[model samples]
Target: MAFVKTSGYRGLHVFAPITPTREFLDVRHAVIGAARELARRMPTRVTTNWWKEERGERIFIDYNQANRDRTMAGAYSPRPLSHAPVSCPLEWSELAQTDPHAFTILTVPNRLRDQGDPWATMHEQPGSIDVLYSWWESDLADGLGELPFPPDFPKMPGEPPRVLPSRARRPD
Candidate 1:
């Protein structure tokens, strides 16, 4: 179904509609490159799926002085969906065979936020989307972001240890 018809999220799907300026795009590319490097360093494989939008109610992300809008591209910083650069939605899903707690980063178009029936165009070809970004959260928060790994966490070649030798082996 079209993402627009969806309502508020339950569980851990936190929708974040990001409006990227030319500058933001540069940052995103850098981040993506870094993630790729990190994957190579770690044992777990990491991939990204970038999404784009082409529909109603364009997302105008304001990122300026935090107060008065000194938006990028001037008034066009958050231009209409039609005018914005092609956005790439990068979704990262981490799957570790040894790790029981796995989470997914869902990147989708702003269309998902529409309260009305935005899926009407699914039958026909849809236009460009308005918003896109990744949402990362834990499906199992019981002890998420705060649990200890096994004593012998495998370390990939060339990868640095999570802690220095001194820290890994508590100073006695």
Candidate 2:
């Protein structure tokens, strides 16, 4: 759960130390693969940058907080509530057992911290494998509609437009 640094575009800083099972591959590869899969499911963009590291690998995913808000009409229906419910990570040990190949079924806005650092962490596998099986009992896909847009967001069409405030007037 180490905070890397704030991204140039968004306020979200790059976080690392997400303990995972045996990581024979590089961190960027794993993260990019996961994010690519996420892009296939959602209507969002993702980016990554490489930085120097001493030991274990580090992966970074940058997303716009503003895009979180959009029309959720096609999401959940029949249900009275506007959004669906989601579940949190069961435990750190549980996530360790999760099959790395399994496409994560995120019921909630997943935080990287909960996933643990795959670069340095280790756990038993095969028989007694622990995994954070996201509760898919409910329509969590529908619940994604509940998330609100980021704060101080500009109401406009197309990639959220940005505008700088006017400069202060100088005294005479």
Candidate 3:
């Protein structure tokens, strides 16, 4: 898995390179499928819940970022935070020991000279996302399906109702 510190933000933006053979919906489905599997495998640590109230203490996947028109930063992109933190790339081995706040506009130059670029060959061998789509289909058969979209997007087919569970009108 590839992850970058989001300008010293509390969370990391995680993703992988795909072959770019699918459209938006298909890619989203794959992401959801993969996230579900991850949540299942590491139930206490990860989640795919769209609603913050339901996520409990897990690290949410934020799969909605898979939606079209999403915005994300690449390695070395600066964020408009007070300390001028940059979206720093990471090696898988060092992720546990690394501190997001340590990299910034002033420090990254020295870091690059010391460690080289972790994302240098990221796109060299694009992998198929097809297996994740297959996981999506399997999930569908098991009654798991599309998730809720953001407020600005159009409702999608097979999507669960937009209402939050706590606020859904109950039968009288």
lDDT of each: 0.26, 0.30, 0.83
Query: Weakest 10 consecutive residues, lDDT, candidate 3?
Result: 1-10
Q: Considering every candidate listed, which one attains the maximal lDDT?
A: 3
Q: After superposition, how far is residue 33 of candidate 1 from its true place, in Å?
A: 1.3
Instruction: Write model 2 residue lDDT over 55-162, tens digit each, in one string.
Output: 123333432321334222111112232333222222334454533222222322343455543323222222211121122112234342111123455553332223
Query: Candidate 1 at residue 164, lDDT?
Result: 33
Give candidates' CA RMSD values in order: 19.2, 19.6, 1.6
Give the clash count for model 1.
10
Worst 10 residues of 2 by lDDT: 128-137
Q: Which stretches of candidate 1 lie over 4 Å from their true place?
A: 1-22, 43-45, 49-172
lDDT of 3 at 172: 95
Could you give candidate 1's per-residue lDDT for residues 42-113 as a string of tens digits?
Answer: 524332211112212322121111212222222101223332322221122321121211111221234233
Model 2 CA lDDT for position 170 = 44
Alpha-carbon deviation at 70 in model 1, angstroms: 19
Assess candidate 2 and give its lDDT.
0.30
C-alpha root-mean-square deviation, candidate 2: 19.6
Could you give the candidate ranking by TM-score, starting with the highest? 3, 2, 1
